[model samples]
Target: MTERPNMETRTILRVIVCDNDIRKIVLPLKPQTVDSLLEQLEEKLGLQYKFTLQFEDPDFNNSLVNLTDIADLPDKPTLKIVSLVTTPTPSTADTEILSVASDDPCHSLRTAWPETFEIPNFPVDVEYRLRQGNLQYMRDQTYLQLSGELKHEILEKLSETIYSYKAYPNKEDFEAVAAALIKKHPCLTQPGSSKGWNGWYDSLRWKMGNYRSKLRRAGCLEVSINGGKRRGQQPQRNVKRPKRFEINFLPNFPDGEDEASMESKRKEMVEEMKKRRLNSALIAQNMNSTFALRRKELIEKEPAVKNTVERWPALFTNGQKSNVNARRTAVLHGLPLLLGEDPTDFYKTCFDCDSNEDMLDTAIGIMTVIPEDSPTVPYSLHLDATTTAIILEGTVVVDNLENVPQAMCLLFGLIYALNLEYPAALKSTFDFLQRVILSLGHKSLKPKIQSLKKSPNAVMFFHG
Candidate 1:
């Protein structure tokens, strides 16, 4: 007779395939080799052809890195069933060579992120906790509440994986990792966010920062140059970090030049803008050449809006593209957050803007609800069914806009371009766009922004 498996560690897992087309019945679980698991799955799920069963590796921010090995097929791990016949992604190829470098994830000579990466297996204790979490999730629907230790393990692994790609991941990149984590394991979804992973997003962001700091201290060249002391002239301002979808967040000064030469080029471009009118292509060319220099002024100098405009007037004037000018706004305005109400509760009314005139009409009510008796900036949008224009300080700043949405977008850029204050009544809504979305303004979040980003029940405040 064959040797009996240990009864103490014995677990019976029943597989439930949600798709009816697959012709599934309950499948019995037997932990052994990868081949055994495949054999069991093929019969029960009625998979007719060759396929790969990829497990979700919690180590690499729940990325589908579990391609092969019995080591990858941990007990109760999350699974991804991919058909072998499908076209492969760049990250899915089974090359013996690693796409990302093993020794130095950062400081690579490559211009872009690696298409594929593989993380090391999780520690035994971390794997045990993950198995327990998956088991509990299977029993009921309770999401895993990660303790401090487990959380740190996931963060550290993810930070290394991200460094293999890019050292400075912007807001969208951070969201992508957090989203993938929850997508792979619904159990790991933090309770707070409607997105279910906003907390993870925040955690990963901080973890990347801390990880970079540690690397910098250990003489990692990629992160070492980014230290505050090494940054140029203005020392008291924010450290230069990636603001948007930047490929090189903090590139060195173009080989042959220094700060004074860049300053000369910037001046030449300012004069060139006047000669070529506001619509010159040279404006962009110069701007591109001086990107590193511009970052220093923006990050180190921390100039005021008017000061920024004085450096380049053409910059603000060139920002009125029709698509970029406007976006679809909500039927609901900022009244919900201003009144301390949960905005998601009004999703029905908020999204239905077909016949809604809330954006135009809401301004009149904003004055009444604000703590101060008087209105700020003479705020309102004028729409007589022909065209809409934003009225700021009793002056129609720009006219012939397509809709209120475009007007709002144009007005927002103007607020920065012209160095204007956000109207007091809608300050929270405006602040949400600046501090939360764009990552502008003070480093420490204000109360309203904190409420929007961190408060579990508080969805983002909007303006429409």
Candidate 2:
């Protein structure tokens, strides 16, 4: 028998030759030596100078391998070609000039350079490009420290860029501006820095917002008051102000009238009152007694009685009396009445469990076993056991019970019942309870209560 070669499969390798000139070459999986690959590169690229091949790892850490050694290349292999030639170094004066230019603020902006320096025009249109460069140059470390006129100039240039482009200073624009500022002035991002990027970004956004608002307001004013103006036309400078009118405080006064004129005026007033059907005694009675009783009835029936009282405070308070506590109690009592149950009986059955700890524990246990289909085996075993380890034993569990799921379910049951009998009270109590749960940080109870809110049993709990 003769040994066979696996010719059924082949691997293609992507090779990158990096040097003064970079090139990419692909090679097939064949039993070729390393020297053969180099020869192919030399022939293809027309290399006249001798070069050494190295793997393109960081700092060229891989050892130099023998050219005759078989190369075990992976699917994509990157190789470098280095020429054996010495390059000239810059003179000390040239190095010093380069260093100074990098530190100079005006290096990036030729227009802002010394007045004696003349910049030759390039073939490309560079006005917008130069403006962008100057905008970035404003963030340089040296420029960051400059104040007064220079700072104002930077802001003016930024405003001009935004106006020219009509770019809104949104989150993306803010991030781009902040990133450029941080890259050029890293100290602005550091803690305790007086010139932080946050304040700078906020100031720029506020200026843009104010400028946009002023333009909008001006356009609206022109449209409403002056019907706007023609394009490219200056507004009239000496526009006349509208004339002001004086109001007569005593238009119907009879101060300088004779006896006949006064008598005629009195008769005319009586005739006008009669035509309007005005009765002074009835008006006085309604204002003193009937209106007060009707307002009290409205307050009692209104669900958001708190807001009603806030709007018309005189409804609950007079100069000599305040009924704040009385109204709050009425609302509290009316909440349970909305469920078609006696308020006293409901409170006695539910909230009155505070004094009886054993009954409260039993109620909690019953709530845990609700829905009937819940896995009761483990809970039953725990309940049957007398060992302290298996049983829950603590007074704080009942006393410190905040807005948990079970309590939320009970509250939802009340709300659903109120929804059926008295929808007005249901809406008010729902909003109030939501605020209470949010303030108590019991957000986890929300989903469970919402799920229960859709249950049919919530409307009539005795049926469940």
Question: lDDT of each structure?
Answer: 0.52, 0.34
lDDT of 1 by residue, 53-72 (tens): 65545564333343577666
State in Å the error of residue 59, model 1: 47
TM-score of each: 0.30, 0.17
Top candidate when judged by lDDT against the true structure = 1
Clash-forming residue pairs, model 2: none
Question: Which residue ranges in model 2 land beyond 4 Å of their true spot?
Answer: 1-143, 184-196, 213-464
Instruction: Give the Å error, residue 233, model 2.
Output: 28
Residue runs of model 1 more than 4 Å from their true location after superposition: 1-100, 106-121, 229-464
Residue-level lDDT for 21 in candidate 1: 17
